[model samples]
Target: MNRKIVEAANIAINNLLPTKSRSLYDIAYNRFKKWCAEKNVQLYSENVFLSYFSENAKNYKSSI
Candidate 1:
């Protein structure tokens, strides 16, 4: 059941983005997955996202 959910999420991630931005999204998503594995983060939650982004916030710039 978990495997199927992961597969579906991957498919949705791959298919839902616009063509020109899909590559960037895939790269970012794969990198996040790698980070999760390295940190042994098995579960996804709001805190997971907050931690990831907070730790890497300096790497991104505001569009505004």
Candidate 2:
């Protein structure tokens, strides 16, 4: 990714949370980025998100 996009993504993620939750959000975002890297997913889209969450959903159980 280009520097501008990377910076924008960082800023966007950081802005999604208050200060205390930033670290946790960062961990999840980094993992998603790493998964994208492993899967050679250079572009972002709704399908990519659906695929990722579908594949990983087994690892997260519902709280209800």
Candidate 3:
């Protein structure tokens, strides 16, 4: 993967999940990757994340 993309993905995931939540984070990361794939969006794109959360927040019960 491109280093910037990798950095961005890591930062994005880490920002949402703490170190102690690794197991649950894996599920979320997988879901995020799958969502990005389904939407044809860059996995590391801020807009992609925004769109994902916007669309799924009701299902996920997120305050963001």
> Candidates' TM-scores?
0.68, 0.73, 0.56
Tens-place lDDT digits, model 3, residues 3-43: 99999999896788677898887998899888888878754
1 or 3, which is superior by TM-score? Answer: 1
Instruction: Give the candidate order by descending lDDT.
Output: 2, 1, 3
Pairs in clash, predicted candidate 3:
none
Report lDDT (Cα) of residue 13, candidate 2.
70
Name the regions of candidate 2 deviating beyond 4 angstroms.
Answer: 1-16
Per-residue lDDT over 1-64 for candidate 2, one digit per residue giving the tens place of the 0 to 100 score: 7999999999997687899988888899899999999999999999999999998898998889
Best by TM-score: 2
Per-candidate count of clashing residue pairs (backbone under 3 Å): 0, 0, 0
Q: What's model 1's overall lDDT?
A: 0.90
In angstroms, give how far residue 49 of model 2 lies from its true place. Answer: 0.3
By TM-score, the better pick of 2 and 3 is 2
**Given candidate 3, what's the lDDT at residue 16?**
81
Worst ten in a row by lDDT for model 3? 55-64
Q: Return the top candidate by lDDT.
A: 2
RMSD score of candidate 3 (Å): 6.9
Order of the predicted models by TM-score, top scorer first: 2, 1, 3
| Shift in Å, residue 13, candidate 1 | 6.5
lDDT of 1 by residue, 1-64 (tens): 6999999999997788789997898899999999899989999999999999987888888889
Residue pairs in steric clash, candidate 2? none
